[model samples]
Target: MKAIVFGSTGFIGSHTVEQLILKGHKVTAVVRSHSNVAFLQSLDVRIVEIDYSDTASIKEEIEGHEVVYNCIGSVGLRSKIDLENAVEIDLTKKLVRAASLSGANRFIQLSSIVVYDFHSSEPLDESYCIKPQYLIQQLLLKREEVVRKIGEETGITTIILRPASAIGRRDYMSFFSRLFQQHMNDQFPLLKNGETKVSLVDTRDVGRAMEWLGNYPFPKGSMNLFLLKGFDTTWKSLKEEIDYERGIEVTICDLSNIVEDPVSYTLNTFRTHRVWNDEKIRKLGFTTKYSQRESVKDAVQDFRDRERI
Candidate 1:
């Protein structure tokens, strides 16, 4: 199988490209410049250089691939959309348009579980339309809808995978992963009510899910792929684990004392408590190799081993 991946040098994209190549599928990794080239080269993936935000260029570059995986995403939060193409309307539209024009057989859009508004007492499912609260989440929801429409109208076999908090070592850390790093280094000051629960899925699991979809033929339409975050962990537990490893309780800045950067600690940590439902993904033959504790522990260990903390 010939597979093409956008943002192939990114955290999840690089991992996905490696998995595809290991499975004997020739992989074409999209990169924007020389820095992107080095990372994809480390994976030994075929490189295609194009601006991810450009439609005509992406269409030209995306041709002749059996499947295209939209793993492109903004790495972290920001105040404005133009600073980075993080906003969904501008960012996702480019990818979707390219895939539609490319006429690929399968389009696997790697999306976020945050699309569903996290207000449910029960586990969140595909049917739930609570919508995204924050800026990034809102953009993802719009992107998902547009992808579904393209699949329906053009007969593109579109499969959407919404992984909850992808875990594993990569060139960069995720929004939460950075915060976790901060917690480990005593850099995250203002630890307000650290009770918020987080659901995590190993990046290996994400790779497996992509492989599974590549092998299995999907019906002509769209499907929501997700791993329910059944297991939940708190920042306090994460801190405990780090403390056990380092033999020193990392300093957690007082929550009560407020400052300008309140969102970094207080607001973000408070909102991460929502759980994700992954039953849909399990029904499709994907199993998580790492349990919540195991994955988190391994992630924390990686941080220490790499001296990222």
Candidate 2:
């Protein structure tokens, strides 16, 4: 199978490219000119640098690929919130239009589970209502809408994947990563005694799921959505796991005293229980390789090995 992946340099995108290659699929990794392709360069695939601002060029680049994977996203936690939201929404609109024009067999979008109204104690699935609250979550909801509309109008097969918190190597920007880093540096923040539940999925498993969906045969003009959930655990349990792995007791600070920063906002996400039911995808023969504890352990070890602590 031939696949074209946008945002190939990102955490989840990088793993997806690697998995596709390992499965003997022909991949074209689309990246920006300033992207660090050191890892991608080592892989057996075609690397294409294209101007994201030019929709025509993006369309041309995606042409002839059996599957177009949209993983492009903004790492704009530190930037102007409005600008970041605009950029994300605009890019998604362009990608959907470009993929539709390219006539790809399937368009796989890497969405987030936060789009769902996750206040309920029951697990969320594709049927859950979308009631995004945060600025970022609102933008994601809009992005998903654009893809769905375009896919329906153009008669293209669209698959939307709402993956839970992803954990593994190359996830230095994730909330869990930041929390782990703070814990290592003795500045961890304790939220409600660190008792909120979090559902985390391994990056490799996310990649495998994308690959499976990309290769799966969908009926013509089908629009499918799935939630990818990993193992579930509480923040306290995760912290204990980290403490046991690192052989040190992390200082847990009062949450109220911690200044409002990106990391703080991230930690606050667990103030509400976030869980998803992925039986829909599981029934499709998709399975995760790592448990939640193992996923967190691997992420911490990866950071340690990189000497980031």
Candidate 3:
């Protein structure tokens, strides 16, 4: 099978490309000029150049692919100008159109768990509806509509995977990654009580899940879960693990309420608004290879091994 992957140099995209090749599928990796192509070349995969933020650029590169994977997204890193939203929504709309027109077999979208409402107070499934309180979240909610419609209208097999907080090698330095790094360096601050419920997914599982789903034809569309961790990783457990794993004393504070007003607004949103119930997707055929604790240990070691901590 031949496949096309956007954001092929990104954390999730890179892993997807690796899995695709290992499964004996040919891959064409499309990425912006600024993305490092050396890594994709190292995998013996063909590389195409294009920016997903541009419609013509994407439509051109995706013209003759069997499968198109959309993994493009941002997290509070862009300017507040309206153009950012336009870029995001426009690219998604354009990609969905291009894939359908090209007679692609399947369109897989990588989305965040943030689409679930924070007030639900229960485990969320695909049926759980979300009302957007933020601009970015609203864009994803809107993109979902576009993807679902394209599938219905064109009979293209479409799938969306909402993985929560994916982590692995070369990961973007998130609070979670920072936490792991701190433990590795024995400099982890005891931020609020880690009592808040959080979900995690290994970056590796994300690639595995995508490869597994590629076989199932989805005329009606399906959304799957790829959560590798539990609902919460307590502060006590986090600290204890650091001490045991690295043989060092680490401090953990009970700043669970810091989520009320995080140092960065993005973190505040994570602490307060995001929630997901992956049980529905789990039943569909995806499973995680890493738990929160296992992931934390691996994440810490990766950081140390790379940074020489």
- Of the candidates shown, which would achieve the greatest TM-score relative to the real structure? 2
Top candidate when judged by lDDT against the true structure: 2
- Tens-place lDDT digits, model 3, residues 1-309: 788988788887888988888899888988787787767888978898775556666676777778888877645533473634566667777888888877778898887775655555455667766676566667667777778887778777788877777767666655566666666555654444444455566777788777776765555444332433344454456567667767788665334455443244354443452445666656766666767667667766776676774
lDDT (Cα atoms) of all candidates against the true structure: 0.68, 0.82, 0.68
TM-score of 3: 0.82
Model 1 spans > 4 angstroms off: 52-56, 82-91, 171-173, 187-193, 223-231, 245-247, 254-272, 297-309
Judged by whole-model lDDT over C-alpha atoms, candidate 3 comes out at 0.68
RMSD of each: 3.7, 2.7, 3.6
Stretches of model 2 off by over 4 angstroms after superposition: 75-79, 83-85, 256-268
Per-residue lDDT tens digits for candidate 1, residues 1-309, read 888988777777877887898889988988777644655677757787776556788788778887888887753455454423445556566666677678777888888775655456455666576645566666676677778876777777778877777667663658547667676567554354566566767776677678777768667555545544435666566566556655667777565555454354235545446567677767866666766556656666776666753
- Ordered by lDDT, highest first, the candidates read 2, 3, 1
lDDT (C-alpha) at residue 142 in model 1: 66
- Model 3: how far is 300 from its true place, Å? 2.5
Give the per-residue lDDT of model 2 (tens digit) for 137-179: 6777778888899899988899999998888888857777878
RMSD of 3: 3.6
Using all chains and alpha carbons, the TM-scores for the candidates as numbered come to 0.82, 0.91, 0.82
Error of 2 at 2 (Å): 0.3
